[model samples]
Target: MPGILGHRASLPRQLAFRFLPDGTDDAAVEWTYHDLAEHAAAVATGLLRRELTGHRVVLALDPGLHYIAALFGIFQAGATAVPSFPPTGKRALARFLSIVEDCAPDVIIADTRLADRVAQFEAELPASAARPHWMFVDDDWFRRAAGARRPDGDTRATVRTDGPALLQYTSGSTGDPKGIVLTHDNLVSNCRALEANMGYEPDRVGCTWLPPYHDMGLMGTIMLAVHGGWPLVLMPPAYFVQRPYRWLKAVTDHKVTISVGPNFAFDICTSSITDEELATLDLSSLRQVFCGSEPVSRATLDAFRDRFGPRGYDETSLIPCYGLAEATLYVSGKRTGSAVKTVWLDKAALENGRVRHLTAEDAEDAEAADAGRAARIVSCGEVAEGHEVIVVDPGERRQAEPGRVGEIWVRGPNVATGYLGKPELTAATFTARLADPGDELTYLRTGDLGFLHEGELCVTGRLKDLVVIAGRNLYPQDIEHSVRSAHEKLRGAAVFSVPGESGEELVVVTEFRGTARQLAEEIDAVRDAVTAAVTAGHGVAPADVHFAPVGAISMTTSGKVRRDATRKAYVQGTLKKLTPAADALPLSVR
Candidate 1:
């Protein structure tokens, strides 16, 4: 039997990937179909020799052809793949270790850079958790992967695993990391759904700057390209962040039709890149650009489309999508070629479970009285074929009323079975059933809150991130936006609720790009502006506003502000506090 990616070896000399360290159109390295398959076959042989056929193997490597081959090789060997987040520094290694402990993998295959740190991580973990054997994918390993022995009789393709094919750990942006167990069938089915939903084009290239550790990168770009047999152009996330123009340049040079990223990538292009760069980019070849793994901001969408509209960019190419690791990615998204749709509502009214689409006059009048309070939500599109998406009050375990705000729940063949080594969590998160007797399939309870409007899904905010105060519901993104606009000195913020004397009070922790020297003179003014903006927008001032320099706000590897961790740091008096005598501020958090 032909394995999922094994058939791609026969595509002969078909180009598989052209990667650039700086994400430029210039290729630092390139690989063909045979290169990927043969190298993966070599890695599979090594895994089989070590008898890791049914065990969990962690992959800790940066984005490149070699990393991709290791992931496919694990799948080819019938061993589950667990890709670790590329560690940011020594400080973040602890959190990375916690993830390994939770998954309890049998082995860790790491890139050359992390080989030494893995030993440090092992020394820190408990004896039981430190039992995982380490395999380094250094230069020697890569050379061996090129010329290593190949297992006979298709042993690399055969499977004996009782568990799923892929064990993807959540990025821990919203909560603790857990291994999402996705089977081979689940991944194949989801890819088919993606092709059908996005209107797959056979001729165009696949382009991405997302890191391979995240689901959007691993499944959407790497696995999606391999399965669809498309030549792909891949780049690391840092390269794109450093040179935002490179992504568009590669897309234009390669005639890439498909790409994916969070809303921020498009926003960065609109804000940071110069007009000279824009003139050089011709993006007419792009057909479907899926934005997910974070909230899709309408302002960001409009800015990107308008900024590039002159250069043959189509508004219909922008697709806002909703998915989670538990669903093996690509759960539901906008139909390709559909116009981007947005609904504006009165921010005050939106807190009360009403989705009232506002007229232009109403929105202007509302914003005039209460700046930064207009709520504009973009739809995440219709549910995928062979999937059921519903909104239910998680506390009641029953379906929500049409157009009523509730937790987003999804059930489909593409949803993963459960979280690895977490029976209670798996049951609570994956075994959700609608109170209705008719539909018997289990639903995965996405902790996100959203409502359906005329059949399209509109995600509001995470249930965990919702800020409640004085019997009103508030989304932190709106509050943070208001704060950012209220003061030029403020660069970033984390907004949440803390217990007050009467009820839950709003807490806003601000991070500034400027120095404490400037803040000593203007801090009072900044505070007043923030307070006034919060009062005008949300009808209440923040209970406490603490200012910290950049990097004071905790965040996950995916760049999501870890609100819970931030709150903990704030309560413990650990978040870096700005003082008049502190001299200067550190640069922005990376």
Candidate 2:
């Protein structure tokens, strides 16, 4: 035991056991380090008896002590853990089966509910191939497993640090999901980096309701708690969705110091909380509210702070961050106690590959200048320690200047190896370079578009998601923001880039807060405003503008807007809408 194994050996002894305060069966449910170690050994022995070693194991259990025990057990058995969301429908189940076939896991450990689902999948899978052995997370299994002896030596010794520890499947952003291979070193390095970046202490406590299937939920919250020996309070994602303020109340109840989620969670919490609820909630212990996994909206952050600040929520605790699964978790985060810094830029300059700063007064004079200006696109702070981030041209051959927008590339110990079983894509994405003398540099090509200003990373938009029209790059965020701001009736909108017969076109999908006829007028007003804004601001017009009821937008398990899926649904005529129309082209184009 050397680098990380040495640290792991002492963790059980040094750390304290703290379960979810509100929801456990009994006081005995709180497992100590010695108890966890013994349980892990029992699961490991059980797995070894089944001849399942050095293979992938999938876990589809809800958030609880057993789920945590299963994860540690898989690692203790020298196997890779593939944690995924429970299959929702036939299509999603088929996709999971396809992934299982590809990965060829040795066993599947799921809750009783999920086991039934797997049994249904078994009926469909061929009999020739080796079917995964199923293990149900139940009281019988726990009782039988608890009394087993602990493994003598390091189970992780056989597992190299460079080898894969976790297989995180992407949310089918491009198409079908592909597992991202993250190594032990990558995980440990990121945890250590984030711990340092967030200034985690031994006494700190974290509360999260994010689904474990999401990268941020697993790596950013769960693993970080384990590695740092912090007390963690876990809640079901459904619980949070049904009552968003429960997350806040949980924090208030537990005196939780840290929490994190996407922008939508904040929006939900702000929208759902009544004034009386806010008055009773005490969030004084809250220090860091990390926001990421989607486009971070300053408006959402500001509204949440304004609504809750009176109830002991600190406005300075707002920490807007930037990260993706490819890089493991976080890349950059704002410093604690700092207001989120946002810049307004000329929209035309941004579209035409130019970055020009604009002031509010200057924006009103010229439409191009107004179009050039983007608002409250928060600065995600400087690169994390032990990481190097650079903005490069589309080809990734040359570096971009400070004020120019380009693709973001990162070289760091925290970066993952690549997507599992996709060698061509791995080669395309991860590259060896000699950017500096004797550098031996390896960089991960993030499809995110951003730029560096005064050594800080400002994420503009996704490279693939960028809408190129009339030789300009129109980011979806800007379009969505413009449409939402255009009408008081249309709210909670998402704009996406849709391909048309001619080329790429902008599609604005909004949720109307009124009746259909009134919503139609509001939509028309949005369309006109968006068209004028895009034409004046970015020299392009939207191809179509659509209106739907509230809650029409699709989100991932982590609450990220599924722009690609939304576009697909719209193209297939599957999207439900009150009124959808093809708008007139920009006057400049006609």
Best by lDDT: 1
- Count of clashes, each model: 0, 9
As a whole number from 0 to 100, the lDDT of residue 571 in candidate 2 is 84
* Candidate lDDT values, in order: 0.81, 0.74
Give one digit per residue, the lDDT tens place, for model 1 in 1-590. Answer: 12656687775578888887678755467888887877777677778888988788888777788788888889888888888765556655765677788888888887776767766677877887647887777557868666557534453757633347888887664336778888888888788889888665769688988878888888888888887888899888888878888889888888899998887688778877899998898999989899988888887888888899999899898889999888889777898999988877767767976666788777877777667467889999999898989899888889887656899999888789998778999998998887777867788999999888878889998999999887788998778867877887786789998888898989999997677787776776888899998888778789889989977887655556778888888888888977755334333211
Clash pairs, candidate 1, are none
Local accuracy of candidate 2 as per-residue lDDT tens digits, 1-590: 12332355456464434555344213324555555555566666777667566789987666766777777778777788888655566545665676676677888877776755666788776676579888787667778876664456433336687888888887764346678898888888888778767884556878888878689998888788777766677777777777787788878887889999998788778877888888879988988888888878877877888888888988678788888898888898888777777766676678777789877666545534344455446788768889999888866456787678988889888888888888988877877453456656668888898888777888989887777776877777767766666766667666677667987777877777766556444554566776776566455666777777776776666766677777788888887787533343233322
Q: Residue 459's C-alpha lDDT in candidate 1?
A: 94
Whole-model lDDT for model 2 versus the true structure?
Answer: 0.74
The segments of candidate 2 whose C-alpha lies over 4 angstroms from its true place after superposition are: 1-29, 88-95, 124-130, 148-157, 173-175, 200-202, 359-374, 432-440, 484-492, 499-503, 511-541, 549-552, 578-590
Task: Please give the lDDT score for candidate 1.
Answer: 0.81
